[model samples]
Target chain A: MPRYALLVEYDGAPFVGWQRQASGLSVQQVLEDAGASLNGGVPAPTMASGRTDAGVHAEGQVVQIDIALGLSPERLRDALNFHGRPHPVSVVKAAHAPAGWSARFSCTGRGYRYRILNRRARPALQAGRVWHVQGPLDAEVMHRAAQHLLGRHDFSAFRAAACQAKDALRTLDRLDVERQDDEILVRTEARSFLHHQVRNMVGTLVQVGLGRRPVEWPRQLLDGRDRTLAGQNAPAEGLTFLFARYPEGLDWR
Target chain B: MPRYALLVEYDGAPFVGWQRQASGLSVQQVLEDAGASLNGGVPAPTMASGRTDAGVHAEGQVVQIDIALGLSPERLRDALNFHGRPHPVSVVKAAHAPAGWSARFSCTGRGYRYRILNRRARPALQAGRVWHVQGPLDAEVMHRAAQHLLGRHDFSAFRAAACQAKDALRTLDRLDVERQDDEILVRTEARSFLHHQVRNMVGTLVQVGLGRRPVEWPRQLLDGRDRTLAGQNAPAEGLTFLFARYPEGLDWR
Candidate 1:
């Protein structure tokens, strides 16, 4: 058996999430089925770096899979992409991985991007791809407010109730809010995130941007250490799993 | 009647192009209905700078509409966007035009952008928004070939049989092809274009990029003036109406 690392991209609107679930179709099932088609009809399981919520897209999701057949990386990618046809999922790249490597445990950092269409009109081409927020929003204020969550902290305010993580302490590497034309983009990177942490932070920052809350709002929520005292979770459609960074010298493009 | 100029944007996947036809829903009809919603029961008519083909999107399409009510430009824009809900069309901006100004006649230049996803894997997020070319495409050679089609020429080789223009002679101001990662962007600007001109040129450029045709192929096509000898018309979904440039002084922001 050969282990391979795959870089996947997908429009999450069609899948339940990145993981396999009993409820409905998932990105994992689609990839596994594609792998099985090439592996003598034998099941091939896959593991991803993280699990995204439904309707949350991914630009560069890393996954690991084991296959019975030894195929070239390019061939494997092409075959998987062909089998994944009619579905909005693509295998961007494939490479042979070291025997002991893992997609989940070896990942060093993860990045996410959230888009808000901050204009009076609803979106057209970007309808399902962005959060359409009407009225004025000050990105500078949001950026100022986002800095409060930068360093190591107990992020219970931004954690979801359903989050199963044992500890609430994590170091936030970056959180940037910027406006381009009629859009407000929220980008964040960290070693890991609690369930819905990025969405909750964005939702809270939006309140600060709209002048509904002061710039110190996020700091207050962090100090309170209460999820109920924080802002609402931003819609899932606005979020995108940007990328997962691995340590240097991985030898995979 | 107060004549207004509207800056419109839309996802053309669901509509029958920008004109109102007998077959299906159109962007024009959607705008007219949105306009009529605010103008009592009277039907509002509109004229556009250009008529886009089916599945052709728009970023800054300019249209002229006559409304009976005396409302501020922002108010009119908000109202139209409100009524256009559930549809993919949006009025980005609205402003009062000069008494005799026309969106079509007053336009001095038109621009279009064509996107090609040149990769082995099919598109995931940009499915309908780009032309996915599975294999290699030399964008540098394509850019070299595109230059041969610039300047004034008889473009019968690129014009559709159904083109209503009386003459096939037109000035092509710009045609630049460049690649950013796996995507090839073909951008063009001209005083006007014949039916299917931009798409045909892109299709021909792809042929040149794929090594199927020489870099001077477009020059030969230009000289021969034979549409049947040229490459196919690139799909409409890959084309976007970028903008319509007007004369120096215009109050519409």
Candidate 2:
């Protein structure tokens, strides 16, 4: 079997997250079905760098697929796109993966962007693509508070109760917030994250931005290590998986 | 009756344009219905700065309405938005309009923006919001070619046959083309325009960007004054009514 690394993008409103399940359609099922069209009805097995939750979008999700069909990178992308028509999913690029390269383990970093339409009126142009907040939020305050969680720490307060990761300790590489017009953007990167860590942090930072919590609240939440002490998880629609950063010398095209 | 000016924004995907017609829902009908909800049962009449075609969006469309209610500007905006729930239309701001003020005859200019997604893969996040062009485009060349359409001229070549304007002569204030990443933006402003003028000009400029038309083709098309000689009209989904410029003294809030 030949292994290929595919760069995928999708509007996650119609999906049941990135994994395949028995109940509903998922991004994984769409790609596997598209792959089976080229591989004589046999579904191609795939593994993604991260399993995003439902209603979470992606601009540069990395997925590795093993299939029997041999084709050029461009043809593989075009074929999958052709079979995946009418679905809001696209294969932006595809490349041959090394014999031992794994999409989940070979990636060193991951980036995400969370969007909030901070306005009194409901979203019109950006409906479903952003989280709408009615009250005014101070982006500078949120940015200052976000810096407290940048270094390594035990993020048990931010992790989900159903998180399967045995370790609560993870090093966060970046966490930045900025406001543009009526939208506030929260950008972050990390090696790996426990379930709902990024969204939990965003919810807590929003509290600081709204003046309900102080700048040191994030640090206090870290020290408390109590999930009940943290703010609720932000909605999934605002989060987008930006990219998976791999080691140098890997061909992404 | 109290007259008010409203700065409105809408997705435009679900409505049959900004004007009221015998069939289908229009943005005008939605506003009138919302007004009637506040009024004693009679619908409030409204007029817009421009009558956009079906599927054309707006960021800052201006409208004037006359209603029996004497609510304050802030309360009026909140009331209309509350009644307009579940629809993608929103009134961002509202202010008192003078007795003689008219939205259609507003004493200034109008601006529009057309977005093009220049990429090989089909759009996922921006499916209905942009015009997708698979071929490569040279933005610099397109920008250079767009300058030919500036200034005053008889724009018959870019006008639709059904355009009811008595004269083809008009002054074009601005026409600019720029590319940001994989998207190309065409921005234009004028006191007024013939029907389908912006879309026709965008289509012709795209030809030049794709290397199918010469740089001087726009000049030749303008000089010819034949509508059939110009490129096809671009799709309505890619066009957005950006703003309606009023005199400096009028309070838009």
B1-253 per-residue lDDT for model 1 (tens digits):
8999999999999998999999999999999998997678676889999899999999989999999999888898888988888899989888898868899999999999999999888899998999989769999999999888889999999999999999999999999999999899999999999999999999999999999999999999989999998898999999999999888545654
Best by TM-score: 2
Q: What DockQ does every candidate get?
A: 0.82, 0.78
The collision pairs in model 2 are: none
lDDT per model vs. reference: 0.91, 0.91
Candidate 2 has an lDDT of: 0.91
Q: Against the hidden reference, what TM-scores do the models get?
A: 0.97, 0.98
Per-residue lDDT tens digits for candidate 2, residues B66-93, read 8898888888888889988889999988
Tens-digit lDDT string for candidate 2 (A99-134) = 799989998999999999998777888888888888
Tell me the docking grade of candidate 2. Answer: medium
